[model samples]
Target: MYVAVKGGERAIDNAHAWLAEERRGDKAVPELSVPQIREQMALAVNRVMAEGSLYDPDLAALAIKQARGDLIEAIFLIRAYRTTLPRFGGSNPIETETMTCDRRVSATFKDAPGGQVLGPTFDYTHRLLDFKLAADGDVDDAPLGTPHPDATPHIMSFLDQEDLIQSEPQGAETPADLTRTPLELPASRALRLQSLTRGDEGFILGMAYSTQRGYARNHAFVAELRIGAVAVEMDIPELGFAIEIGEITVTESETVNQFQGSKTQPPQFTRGYGLVFGMTERKAISMALVDRALRWKELGEDNVGAPAQDEEFVLYHSDNIQATGFLEHIKLPHYVDFQSELELIRKLRREAQENIMQEAAE
Candidate 1:
């Protein structure tokens, strides 16, 4: 016989306390500080910030540690914390041209005006696991190289100067935040790009691969990929003048896709853009490709029912946090709902048995 499970609330609270304690792990060892995590687990922090839509590496690192390395949970924490923050006002559109870049590359041109700076990447590193770091990791304290002042201009801008590529007019109005508002169909460029940045790396990569496999084949060239820190400023109406709020590291990517013009316009090259939190080149690149693929409608191309072209499909499925929550929710207390289904089945079986007996007696 089933008895009522008692003290669920208390059990949950106690379990949470235990989890927090376990996350810290041994009082003598000293708690892992946010700065330590940010410095040590830089990549993990970057991923969390990129997906979380908040670029505070320290906070992201702290959340990661608190969640015991659950990246999605860390993202959730950052998202939740971000909501409590008051919006004073938005700042002028960032001058991306003024960005002091660490890494910049273009696949479109052989050699652009600004030389390609392949700064600090795993591209050249061999995939061999380091066995020396089994006891204590070798910490390198190498100083960084001074950056070139005259970095390369955007490839798209160069193409636009020749009227080969379509030049997008700067949007005067402040774009709506996807986080504040519910997502709707037929999204703007800002909304599309925002969703793609926080999207799961693997999911976006697969979608990009699908495009290459002729799903929605649009000839795309990586116009530019750059990673750097940009100052994030906001206007305070009370002060009546904008002040420097903070700075954040970001990865920006733009792709030029070949397209045959519609009935209205002539054959021209279209563009796709991606701006993400931290130095995540791969995500930014994938985002740009997917963004271009999704723009088939605006560009007057036929919808071939490709995965990337379907906005609903990509936006809804790309986030790991959403997928994971739903998937793992089944492991929670779903027994009550199961009991109802079980009861219904039992009732149906009893009714069927009675009907059979009646028929047999007749």
Candidate 2:
């Protein structure tokens, strides 16, 4: 049986009008400018860009404003907008080693090649929210000391040179794009990273937390976490040389985890890598932990059936857009289904009562 509810057009239009007013809030206050959101709410914009797979701050800011500060909604808007744009050739991979880092830290080594520069961080900040920020959004910039002229070498490279850490073979094959193709189980490292990089922050954080609490424990140490601006370049066929496209701020984290070397391999440390748009260290760190946990099979470790270890589970549930659509779709009218369920329950109860009455009479 099927039932169709009619006459929702006017109601939907009225609801949308109300939603528009709600989004604008009180008219007395000036509407938030896209520039204001971009410059002030930079972190939110960054998250939108990162998840949306687009890195335009202005567009991200506009999306944020349109979404009424709902980050997931903003990301959805950006992703939807991105899908309509014409494709250009891919840019070259960023050289993070040459990045002009604003912040660099190493947990493993006390004094690394570049030295421990806590350029700008909330790591040691008091959690107390300053009410003053509500009145004034201005923040004073701190002075930066002279940075090391030499490139900040990776800590893992040093370990790798000494044969203390497992060396990964460089792959010449181009990685698969998750957006272009359907997700397959037992994804490659590149595919897994693509999923993690765009996955919901809270979901990734929770999965990473599970690993710390002894579920597929990886004993990860932050080998190095760097925040900086890297140059983006693209090759122009006409020019026959790569040209600088633009620069983007990024956070990169490398985690060294405990290893269980097998008969063919010697005892060596393994690594998990995370790279995300903007200065999002927390997300990057969390991403790294989850990435490392997912590589149990490749590392010759037993599968403990942990949430982090399940590629299918992590990859499937990590997408917020997909999750949100299914969750919100439940609100749609299911009158026919409900009616069927109601009749079934009523018939079952009636049969039970009749049986009881007959038994009592006997």
Candidate 3:
């Protein structure tokens, strides 16, 4: 519990003022505009948008600037601001199959139907820092490639045709919105996905890595990983039809796990899916690994007691906003609680001394 320490209004005001000054840094350097952050620091903005559970890039950029490039703080700001906004009707599920992919690759297949398009990526880049970039040297524009004429179909669909992979039937039931409702234990796969997508990248990555390191090795193979823009649509009650609201860039990872056959069922490959906002391929891949590990029960696998498999543990601790809030609260005044503990300790020590003295007299 927090004790309200009174009479530091001036100090608080001064501290805030100083913080603003510090955020600006050297007066010689120009201030970072929101557009500059949105365009240049696109990855950071994407992370903020993804974790904040808000799609507004401009607002995310502004939050980043306000928080002085502290992503968690920016996410916190975005989340806080999101709570104040009016809720419109939810958008229809985006069709990733119809996505205009900027980058698409499949590890399972050397040559896929759409053909592999390796878009802007750091996969082949040398790890060494470029002095030219540091000096803000002008660079040549990236050469554009000819766009694919036809829409690329999912790689899993090919596996499905051969009956090689497990089928994922579309659920008729509307998923529970964790934002509107409190997160309950024994969450559905939909809720778990929601939590995972918005979870801390670092925490999720670590959990996913643990699975890879034999915590609960699922033998995941990236069936396909695609980064692209998909149109977001919402059904209009007045029009009785869905219309495109906007488009959002997203990274999708689909992993084919090892075959888990049962006595009653034939052997078939399982699936783990991850879809996140922006070009966050690393987080998307990590999310897929963790997602597969968590599906131990549904897949009729033994509970290995892995940390990732524990639904309650993963969901409860995944949210960085909630985690940081509880953690940072310790810095606030807890004078009464601390004083009570101090007094109890002193009283116990005094009683112990008196008891020793009595024993000596006897």
Per-candidate TM-scores read 0.89, 0.94, 0.96
Local lDDT at 156 for model 3: 96
Please report the TM-score between candidate 1 and the true structure.
0.89
In model 3, where is the ten-residue run with the lowest total lDDT? 141-150
Better of 2 and 3 by lDDT: 3
TM-score leader: 3
Residue 53 of model 2 has an lDDT of 85
Task: List model 3 lDDT by residue over 279-358, tens digit each.
Answer: 89999999999999998887778878889888998888989999999999998888888999999999999999999999
Report lDDT (CA) for all predictions: 0.83, 0.89, 0.90
Could you arrange the candidates by TM-score from highest to lowest? Answer: 3, 2, 1
Which digits, one per residue and each the tens of the lDDT, describe model 2 over residues 117-175?
78767889999997877876666666766544557888788898899998888869878
Global CA lDDT computed for model 3: 0.90
Better of 1 and 2 by lDDT: 2
Best by lDDT: 3
lDDT of 2 at 274: 93
Per-model C-alpha RMSD:
3.2, 2.0, 1.5
- In angstroms, give how far residue 115 of model 2 lies from its true place: 2.3
Query: Candidate 2: where is the Cα deviation over 4 Å?
Result: 1-4, 137-141, 144-150
